[model samples]
Target chain A: MAAESHPGYGMRSHRSTLLRRLLRYVLLVATALVVAFPIYITVVNALLTPQQIAARPPTLFPLHPHWGAFASAFSTGHLGIFLRNSLIVTVTITLAELVTSALAGYAFAFVRFPFRRTVFFLCIATLMIPMEVTLVPNRETIVALGWFNSFPALIVPFLASGFGTFLFRQAFLGMPGDLRDAAALDGYGHWRFMTRVVLPMNRPVIGAFAVFAFLSAWNQYLWPLVVTETNGVRTVQIGLRQLQALSIDQTNIIFAGTVLAALPIFVILVVFQKQLVRGLTAGALKG
Target chain B: MSDTRRRRRLGEAALGYVFVLPALAVFGVFVFYPLVKTFVLGFYRTPPFPNLPSHFVGLSQYGSVLTSPAFLDSLWRTVLFVLFTVPLGIALGVALALLAHQRLAGIRIFRTIFSSTVATSVAVASVIFYTLLNPEVGLLSYWLGGRGGAGILQSPTLALPAVSVVTIWQNLGFVFILMSAALQSIPDDLMDAARVDGSSMWYRFWHVTLPLLSPTVFFAVVVGTIGSFQAFGQIDLLTQGGPNNHTDVLIYSLYQQAFVFNNTGVAAVMSVLLFAILLLLTAVQFRFFERRVFYGR
Candidate 1:
């Protein structure tokens, strides 16, 4: 019916369809393997011992797994402290952004206020201004505040995001008006309604923003490098750079450090796969 | 009653500002204020530290930075990097998206594998490539050892291309996801209609699907170009502006001047230039390409 339905076309035989599907499957798997092979080898190298790594014509797979690679990476590579620093900065920023964006989003969406359009336009304008343009001045600001080398220095600048606010605002705008009226009838003011209904109901947006915020904060290189003068407050990204500079000879150990640095984000990505896709494609569908 | 209603309205307006204050305060201090300071900083030559006095220099800094051979070279390299990455990145993204869009069993697994690079941070991705491209003990170097028996990244000529390879690989996932989303969004009925009109598969794809995909392609190009322009982590890790400064793109050059060389004024000028380029690129994209972008009715 599918082929015959189209005029001037004959229906495709089932066998051809099956064959086409089989070819697609092969192509897809082959491409996936090719894309994934670098990561596979990286993991394999991370699991190999120093001697095995140095062996000529490098071993493709680790015959005997070296679990000690991770232990060394954490203890010696200083990745443990780096990981802790990354978690602290990421969590602090994510929580603060979630609250601020959600609050601002609710204000923009539900509350009729003076100068709302102007304020919203200003907030959205920040999205077009790349963060790299602000690096020099922000570093100066951090120094003036004496927050340099402190957690606040790493966390405060990114506590609120224009993108997060926009994402949440779009989410809030999609809510039915009747629901807001009904909530108002139930004596739920803006604050109460936001906390009780909007926040809970927009879990997907919250989750998406949370994953995005955390990932951005975690992956931040330039800001953390600029602000943090000491290794004590440095994040995993900066620490990875330090490791690369310091331990070029210890290639296997560096791979171990890489694994440790990337593992949590990988786990988060796997767990929050849908939210990541939604967060990423959210911009694509819009502007 | 009217007075009470007016009071309520005023109360709501006050609450709205109150709600927006936290985000506003952060943006005001960090984003907006910094933007203004960047412009001001461009006009003054400041010492490395904050306490030192800064002298006004007008647009001289911009003129010097624009004419500097180092800046000019890096700008040329950056344009090359954009050329190397954007079109190829778009083409590969579209190809992968088209390939994965087919209906088949276990297709979701393939999608996951293709998109997995999104999980990799720039730092992690660079580290992976650093290990993979190490001449002394890298898999790729051992496999594809060319003249001089050095890694591709170690060679002066091949460094940019090697770094470009890492970027292209890292960016493929993002581009693929965006393209696949655009593809999936195209209604099946339109394609069906084309088929009913006796359009061959190639004809349908070229005329119908390709037109529908221009907006996504355009978006990818704009974002990809901006991203490549600002890309620092890969350049920092992979080449450190290189064996010969061949990989010394704009952002890294700015960073070196600002932080390493303590030339904040030069860096500020470069920042302004970068911003202008991005603005111009975005404008050009919309002005030239917007007409071709098919907005489905």
Candidate 2:
């Protein structure tokens, strides 16, 4: 409305608009390059020969690419074992979290139980307690259970999550009430209706949550670092750190291990980024 | 209430308990139990051997941990780390979000690129940064006149900041994604109204957009501060809390006290302290920042 009185105020000439667009493109491109610089340099160094990486100026691009670095790093660093360990841990956690969260979420959403509200609140309250605070006691518990330096130690502590329960509860609550009522008319009980109908309907939320849980498990460093001492059960993240420490002089080999460590997660992320975005935004909204 | 109605109600309650039992079991053993155990363990000096019994030391462990110079320095450094990362991460995220909010060709590509670092784990990022700042073979160090090839991570004064840089970079994608979502939710009609009223760009942002964005920004700050406090991998891979313990944060200090030095009782006290700090900060945010948030719909 105010533009009628001062037409030129908020309006720009076509020429100036074009100039602004150009400047914006330049800025965007520059920022993108800077943001991507670390990945770029790491990849380039991973593919370069040791002598090339050790050059005084440090080769910006690999003039003669050496792909063998990956194979050797995989063999010498036991990266294959690490990757398998990570996959087993991440998949187990994802499946376990999904099942537990879905069950608890269904209870909160549909079932009429005594102390339901209290139980839900207590579960949610666990989010406030950082895992670091429980590290010592958890280690002692694992040792006592005779599960130290094993998959149980690595996976058991994180088998369930409060946040996942909250997310799934919200998802179940969002489902249409009539759907459940109709299923009830067909002699379907809680478990039958949940598995047959409700779970299928909330695939997107479950998928998104699964991706998130997987990412967190895959990227987990501290817990695995503390729990697993032997290379037999070590994760790729810890393996990379150990590789770096051992291969200090072999920069190219270390870079290769780093690339290997990051590659699977990077690919998974790009493929599931939409789910990730939705999951993250959903979290922000609830918070 | 008829007999059938009572029977149905009892069955429903039983089903609810059955459904929630597994999760409750995990939370009991791993979360709540450990929390209570840590508090109890703070009073006992446990030897390094698994078979050795922990003797009750009353409050001696807590006293020592609180009075120790190392713990005090780590506490200060943790505060500084939070201060360093949270504001800068939010600001950088906001800037990138605003920059990429334009309606233009290939804008999605730029958005994706800005958020790419979210995929890199802390270890991956730290390793990349270590090589980049390696002084002897690093490209950035070469550019910075490497002082006979010595990297930034080597200096005691720059160690914390160096680790902070890695932390900021690692968090940039997460913050950008969050802020961009918040910014996109701002209505176009409101912006048009502000512009038609002859308000400048900065004026519209400060008075209109920012007020609406306060909630998301506050969320980012809270999450970022908690994360920065718990940061371990970067410090471990980059500086190892070193160059004279300059980069030692609360979580890293707890790690050292527990595993490295086998001082379990002291570590328990520190964990309790860390837990208290997180609770206090979260409470403060909810009390103060929640008031400023604009829930316009």
Residue pairs in collision within model 1: none
**Among these predicted structures, which one has the highest TM-score?**
2
Reference A-B contact fraction recovered by candidate 1? 0.65
Worst 10 residues of 2 chain A by lDDT: A1-10
Model 1 regions lying over 4 Å from their true place: A1-19, A246-249, B47-52, B146-149, B196-198
Model 1, B118-227: lDDT tens digits are: 87888988988888777777777776764454567877888998888899998888888888877877777777789888878889879998888887788888889889
Error of 1 at A105 (Å): 1.1
DockQ, per-model, please? 0.51, 0.50
Model 2 clash pairs are none
**Residue B3 Cα positional deviation in candidate 2, in Å, after optimal superposition:** 3.8
Candidate 1 chain A: worst-modelled 10 consecutive residues by lDDT: A1-10
lDDT winner among the candidates?
A: 2
